[model samples]
Target: MPDMPTVSLNKAAPPPLPPTYQDPQLLPEPRRCDTGAGIVWIRKAFDMFKQNIGIWLGITVAMFAIMMVLTIVPLFGILSGLVVILFIGSFMQAAAIQERGERLKFEYLFSAFSTHLKPLLILTLLYMVSIAVFFILTFWGMHLLSVSNFLEARVALDSVGVSSSKQWIVMLYMLIAVLPMILLSMAFWFAPALIVLHDMAAMTAVKKSLQACLKNWLAFLIFGVVGGLLSIVLMVFTLGFGFLLVMPMMLLVYYTSYRDIWTDQPLSIDA
Candidate 1:
């Protein structure tokens, strides 16, 4: 049996990393904590972000502009536009993780297209399926409740009479709505993390994502709720400029929190 490797957080992270990375280098070989400054090397990787937010932001905007163009710019076919966008986004994410000088450009977004397209698409579809399944299950449950409480409720509305039947159905619908939120949220909990950190088929990533969430439901929920609320506030208050800050913070938080699995050691970073 291979030795169970020990993970030491905040240790040696690979060099030439981008500045926006506030995480300690997480090596797959021997998993490590996301914080890079304890029992390990203590260096912040976000120098690029702080020093060049303008240029980086411009690049991101350009990429978004290209996406807008594709909607109108007729291509050989829909496939052409989709393929281009997918490559663009994936490459951008992956490239952001590459060495400093080459990090966070519109060009980076297209990096993963040629080599990592199929797996990335598969993972994305798996997340979509999880979403679809959540809705389907909730809808079915609601339909059943509605049937029992509303129209055709008690076939003979005259004889199978019950007081406040509509109210009862409404309660049931609420319960149904809440049920999937609790149950299915776990399935897609770490989907984005899995997609970015590992390469696998969509179905497999979905399975793993669910497993990861179930394994650490409490922690994930806490993380999700806090992040979600912050996002909502940002959207409302700043009219969305808040996304620039919120996005990076949540991304790092998700990445850090997700390291919970596949390693024993823990390192904490403040949100």
Candidate 2:
């Protein structure tokens, strides 16, 4: 008997993959927010702040000190912004824990350092790069303005109480500096939460953040305006010590906004 010929099957080759890397996509749309949601965010933040003011204050101070130290380090100093990213998750965790009726502890602020280090560090680098670009463009614009004598008008608006050339320079610098920072802030606003809480990649989280903000720009504008005014009033009335209390509340507000805008279900307010 002749041996049967062995059968050879040619398996279909896997399709070639695309060369470009695609960013992680977010939900089709963000949760809808109303104008009143902005105020509600501040209120909820205050509630969270009240739950653990001491712990919150301590965490803030410690983080501030850490940031200062990082900024002073020789080579790593430029990455100090990245250092701040390391703690953003911790702060959000602390807030979430408090919302869950748990006692806030200082250790909560360091929790993300253990698990989310890589993405957070990458985010920090991107954040730092954005800031660097912002400043570079800001200074360059100012230089161009100065060199071109663009602002050399004899009459000053004096609307914001500027009278002298020195004042004009300072005011002009500030005006020029604000636009880029505003853009950068909006773009990165939700990136930390997405990266830390939702496990998104750095660039993907950034795109989601920007998308979420763009989808709810009006609410954000209201929040920024009203929140800023209220914060100023609080600080002024309390001779600036109020800022310590308000600072944590503001961060919580930011986190709350992220939750409200990004989460699908109705936000649960801890009783």
Number of the top candidate by lDDT?
2
Assess candidate 1 and give its lDDT.
0.52
Q: Estimate each model's TM-score.
A: 0.57, 0.74
For candidate 1, give the lDDT of residue 140.
83
Per residue, candidate 2 scores C-alpha lDDT tens digits across 1-271 of 9999987688788899876633223455677688667777888788777777789899988888888987988987866666677788778777666655567788988998987899988888888888888888888887887777555632454545557567666676687788677778888888878877778899988888887887788888888999999989988999998878877888887678876888653343441
lDDT of 1 by residue, 1-271 (tens): 9999998887976788554634333334323233322211111213324555665565555555666776667763444344542543453354335422344444555666665677666655654566678788878866765656465544444465655465655665687688677666556444544555455455665576566656555555555565677679878899988777554444334334444453342334331
Best by TM-score: 2
Looking at candidate 2, what is the lDDT of residue 74?
A: 90
Error of 1 at 165 (Å): 9.0
Give the 10-residue window scoring lowest on summed lDDT in candidate 2. 19-28
